[model samples]
Target: MLTPEEWAIVALSLRVSGVAMAVTLPVAFGLAYLLSRGRFPGRSLVDAVVHLPLVLPPVVTGWLLLLAFGRNGPVGGWLEAAFGVSVIFRWTGAAIAAGIMALPLMVRAIRLSIDAVDRRLEGAARTLGAGPWRTFATITLPLCLPGVLAGLVLGFARSIGEFGATITFVSNIPGETRTLPIAIYSALQIPGNDDAVWRLAGLSVALSLAALVVSEWLARRGQDDRAGHVL
Candidate 1:
């Protein structure tokens, strides 16, 4: 049986990961679309910047976020002063850190999906008098739905497993910013918490496996759809 605290951690993890994925999806789609289809100055730079979090140390990324969103920081200060909002040492900061960390995987998956789309098909729609938004809604989005699902699952997994950046940005606060990974880390720091660690570790492994399975299922489903389209 799971303890109340464990259940709280699990529920909070789900909430944080869900929120992160929700916010990241549209931004990921936009970046993927730009990378796959748009052409303009500094495109390469933009691409590099989008994937920077993937390469940088998690701690460094967290520190940067703190500088940008901490209580004393300009953006954070203005937000607090204007709307009484706060991100530092809070759940919101954890979600932001997780989302940023998950962004590269999200963008990569969606960009590949977008690239696989048939431009000729889009052209046909345009020839038939459909505007860009209309064609994208009816054609492009449907074709890439599986990819979007895959990206969302992958991003959710990443967010749930986030640790270094989240800890740096929000610290470990039970029922607030302490997520699954942080809980696991906290378990490790105490003596005779091996059982707790193992239990949490099991949950983490199961979550990761489920994410992988779903992602693969979505990929296969996308492939079948593509085959049908080709036929």
Candidate 2:
């Protein structure tokens, strides 16, 4: 017997994760493009920092976010002063934490795809009177759709399961920051809620598996579409 609150938590988790992925995709793609195609100083350092969250413990990432985005912290203070808003202990904050954790995976996937794209195709587009942005939009982007889809799906799935960073930064307040992972954690904390935990855990597993399947399907479909375009 699932309560309304639990179901709400599940829906909210999906929403937050979806939004996080949506928010991360463009930024990831742009960064990936820059890393793949742009020749710039400090590029290596930028790449390293982008992947830092992937290597660091989620809790540590959360702590860094807290330090940087907390009310008294510099950037956080500026944001608050400028917008009269706060991210700490909020749903938005949880999404940001999850997004940071998932960004490296997203960027890596997009970067690889971009790298694999045929540069000659882009050059051909330039020869046909296309600007850099036009070539990217028409040729590079279409060819790399599979990787972009993969990155989006991966980031969304990761965001769904986000726990340590979210809890550390957002504090797991029920109905606000209590996402699916937080809900599962809360369920396990109760002595007689093993069945509930099992149910939610099953749901979580199903969601993750579904996301994986969707990613694969989208990747394959993108490949097929590209192949057809070539034909």
Candidate 3:
């Protein structure tokens, strides 16, 4: 059981991760479709660049984000000047860092799903007067539902554990940007916050387990649906 403050951290973690996943889904799907199906120059480069965060150290990624999106940075300057939105030391900034960390996983999962979709089904839909968009919506999308769900859940889980980048980018300000993992790290640093540390750890474990179970259930459901159609 968590204290009220600890519980708030857990809830904030979930909200941040969930929002990150939600934001990543459509973007991932679009990127996956372009990678899996589209033809263009520099495609390979684009793919590699998208996956760069996967290989880079978390702190490096965080620093890069800070450089690119900091209040004084180029894009950050433009965004702030245009809309008065500042990402530095903000919850939204934490989510952005989490999203960046989660992007490769989301893209990989979605790409695999897009590849698994039958091109023949897409052709069949086209043959039946479906436009490109309609065919994708009615055929390709449904077939790739399993992968989409898996990617969303995986992205959420990744976001939950994101600390190095998040802390570096957003500074873990309490109640604003201190997620569960951040809280855990801070508590463990204290001399006698053992109870808080243990409770946060337990919460982390439970959340991870729940995410795993949900992913498994979604994958199994997809398989069962496929089996039913086969029968």
State each model's C-alpha RMSD to the native: 1.1, 1.8, 1.6
In candidate 1, the residue pairs with backbone N, CA or C atoms under 3 Å apart (3 or more residues apart, or in different chains) clash, namely none
lDDT of 2 by residue, 28-86 (tens): 99899899988999999999999999889988999999998999998789989999999
Worst 10 residues of 2 by lDDT: 222-231
Winning candidate number (TM-score): 1
List the candidate numbers ranked by TM-score, top first.
Answer: 1, 3, 2
**Candidate 1 Cα outliers beyond 4 Å, as residue runs:** none
Against the unseen true structure, what C-alpha lDDT does each candidate score? 0.93, 0.88, 0.87
Which ten-residue region of model 3 has the weakest summed lDDT? 222-231
Judging by lDDT, tell me the better candidate of 2 and 3.
2
Point out where model 2 deviates above 4 Å. 222-231
Residue-wise lDDT of candidate 3 within 1-231, one digit each (tens)? Answer: 657887788888888887887787788888988999989999999999899989999999999999999888998999999999998988888888899899998899888877877688789899999999999889988988998898888888889999999998889799989998999899988998898888889878987888888887877776765555343
TM-scores, one per candidate: 0.97, 0.94, 0.94
Off by over 4 Å in 3: 223-231
User: How far does residue 89 in candidate 2 sit from its true spot (Å)?
Assistant: 0.5
